[model samples]
Target: MFWKKFNLNKQYNILYLDYNATTPIDPRVLDAMLPFLKENFANPSSTHYFGSNINESVKTARIQVANLIGADETEIIFTSGSTEAINIAIKGVAENYINKGKHIITVSTEHKAVLDTCKYLETKGYEITYLPVQKNGLINLNELNKSLRSDTILVSVMYVNNETGVIQPIKEISALTHEIGALFMADATQAVGKIEIDVDDFGIDILCLSGHKMYAPKGIGALYVKKGIRLPAYTHGGGHENGLRSGTLNVPSIVALGKACEIAEQEMQQDAERIVSLRNELENELLKIPETFVNGSIENRIYNVSNICFKGCDANVMIGRMKNVAVSNGSACTSAVIEPSHVLAAMGLSDDYAFASLRFSLGKFNTKEEIKSVVEILKTELEFMNS
Candidate 1:
């Protein structure tokens, strides 16, 4: 009923199930953003009256974002997106803490932003240990414990896997990293709005999230750096975001992200209840199809995602044929790459099964009717493909 007030035009009669890739901006978020985009526009860093007022709005937004994740408002640093935040967190630590160590530990299944950033660090003589995951898509704690070393500066892990929705053992990982005197970071882009997160409770020294992943507009995100942690400046301009990230603040999108975070804090429990039920119904029915299996640890995943391996079905072809049904085979970032998902491959899936997998990610806007329609469409498409 709440979603009914929002006009989801369902462009081209499509049923969208790709929330992990990005979410449609909530009408409430847009409403909060419009004022900044038009008459209220002012440089938050300026001393002028209008700019002073706009700066207050940005401060409120910072509090809103921090409140959602149980962080102090001062801990939040605005960035362009998760990629930028990840880069700042990883690269900044490497730069500032180079005297202490040059080694970092991250998982093999991390998003390209983290993986590629670590790869780049390798050229600078940093030692990166990419921990492998089990078939259920969870990192082994023992392996992580053994991997921790005196030279390890940071341990970066994602809170949830974008494709399979696999929730990682962040608290345990953080504990292990701390034992070796290393800071812990989490890319919570896919986890922040979808689940509860407390930076202090989880021992997260640094965390990053993208607004677009949580029903806010694109080009806005935040990095949470714990108190007493100092990261090197990411940009060199009029010092913004506590001199960590610089340049003009994106006031409109920041307001939108704040509103989205507020809304998510209020509605996450109910949203999870409804969406998980729909996800279970869809997953159960789809699993009835022959040779289908779920990917990742079903018991340890987020409520909205179901990555299913449909043996013998080419996921790319299946997606292409479903003209009005929007889903994905893997991360949208790597969609252009011809290779199968490195995540699935790291979890020991053969190329065939990896290519056969499809990710169905539900969102608050999706309805039971839409789920049924999607299931029917997939069944029909699979039958035709088999024939």
Candidate 2:
């Protein structure tokens, strides 16, 4: 166990395996944020001493977030969430680089944030190429290369698929995008704190990440724009975040996000080892049920996630049976829609199989005992289904 002794709130007593959807804020992160909420309540933009002190905290947050992704502090732009970050990265790039090209490339299995933003751009006369994924939920580099055009100004691919957890070949894709002088952007919401991510190492021109996906509060995220790359301002106001995003910073959440990043940097390796062990045990035991199989490229996925398909089992019904556990059929962002998962469909799953899938994303707080209990509950539920 990564945590020697941790106490979960009463409301969080049930097993939570939905880390990809959103993580529970770490107690330490909460502690770091409380001071900002209570005492340091001044606006960071004000010239007063209270504001200056808060502003300093925000700068510290910028450095912490930048350090996690190997970016410079000046390159980081604070946004409301990854959705806003995606909008800024895609739309800003489109606006600034439109003179060079009016085309964008992205994968079909991306989060709705990227896909919907691309669709919106299509209304503005920008051409978009939605690349297909293989049955293993992996993109074909050859197909991607073939899709690139001189007019392609950007290629937006996600570092990890929200449902399948399959990681993309970012380095290779970055090289391909750069060959045509286009910018490479990735939605790293699922990969950032879970895996070791260095934007410099990956040669990514723009990257988006959500604090809530790690152990931080929601409504806080950052976009890493490469030093030389210029993105047109998304919000037009006092020109905060290096004139890219404009607004008074959410000091409490910003502090929480920074503290969360610092902790993630320190405990990532240990967390991965322990979480992977629990996930493997859960997967192994869950697969014992008849007609069960894991989805996506298992070898190429993040350690904390396992998307499993229970053949002939309705995921909604399965979750209804396991009342004490928290899981999801797909991205929580799309939970309101009662249709089959778009991510699974892109991987060539039939509507039936897609609806039958469940995403089990573990986290640092999960323990061996919790894994065992969940596995037993699943076995019981499967038996009941057969009966």
Candidate 3:
């Protein structure tokens, strides 16, 4: 009924299961954004009355984001998206803590935003230790402990593997990072709205999340910096976002992200419950195919995703065949690369298995009928491929 109020005519034409790639904007979030785009378009930095009112709205949006993650309003820094937020957090730490240490630790399976940023830092004289994950797509705690050194300035890990839906032990990882007096940062782009995250409880020094991954429009995201942690200015301008990221605020998208966060806080549990059931139904049915198996730790994965490897089948070809269905082989960010997923490679999957994998990520908007249709489509496609 909630979705009925919106025009979902185009969405119904495809069986979209790629929530991790991005999500459709919620109508409620869109409604909250429209006024900001039109009548309330004044710049938040302007000194006029209209600008002051718009500033108040931005303040409210900041509070909404903070509340969702159990952080203070002052800790939130709006950015273009997770990539920008990640660049600020990782590079900022590298720059500010250069005198303290030149070493950093992150998983081999981190998103390219984190990996590529760390690589850039390496060119600047920082030593990066990329810890490998287990076959189950989980990092070894002992290895992580051994990797930590006195000169390690930061340990950055993603809260969830976007491809496999595998969740890391954030609390445990943060505890270990703190033991060695290093900061912990989690790229929570894929986990924020799907799971409950208390940055303080997890001992996170820095965290980044993207709005587009959680039913808000693209080009909006926020970074959480724990109080008392200071990072150098990421952008030079009017000292906006606590002088970290300076630019004209994206008012409409910010409002949309705020509304999405508010709605997520209120409805996440129920949405997860329904989505997990549909995900299970889809996965269980798909596993009936020959040589098919899940790619990650079933016990440790998020409820909405099922990354399965269909042996002897090429994922790209299968995806091409399923014209009416939308699934993915891996993160959309790396889709342009002509290779198997690095995440799967780090998990010790063979190239064949990695290329054979498909990620079905369900969301609140997906339905049982859609799941069944997707399952049937995949079944027929696989049968034809095998034939």
Please give, for residues 1-387, the per-residue lDDT of candidate 1 as tens digits: 688665343544769999899999998899899999899998988899999999999999999999999999999998999999999999999999998999999999999999999999999999999999999999999999999988899999999999899999999999989998999999999999889999999999999999999999999999999999988888988778889887999999999999999999999999999999999999999999999999999889999999999999999999999988889997888899879999999999999999999999999998888899999999999999999
Ranking by TM-score: 1, 3, 2
Q: Which 10 successive residues of model 1 have the least lDDT summed?
A: 4-13
Candidate 3: tens digits of C-alpha lDDT, residues 297-381? 9999999999999999999999888887889997778898869999999999999999999999988888787888888888988
**Clashes, model 3:** 0
Residue 311, model 3, lDDT? 97
TM-score of each: 0.98, 0.97, 0.98
TM-score of 2: 0.97
Q: Using alpha carbons, what is the TM-score of model 3?
A: 0.98
Candidate 3 lDDT at 221 equals 98
Q: Report the C-alpha lDDT of model 2 over 39-90, residue by residue, as the tens digit.
A: 8999999999999999999999999999999999999999888999999899
RMSD of 3: 1.2
Cα error, candidate 2, residue 269 (Å): 0.5
Give me candidate 1's TM-score against the actual structure: 0.98
List runs of model 2 lying over 4 Å from the truth: 7-11
Q: Residue 64: error of model 3 in Å?
A: 0.5
- Compared with the true structure, all predictions reach lDDT values of 0.94, 0.90, 0.93
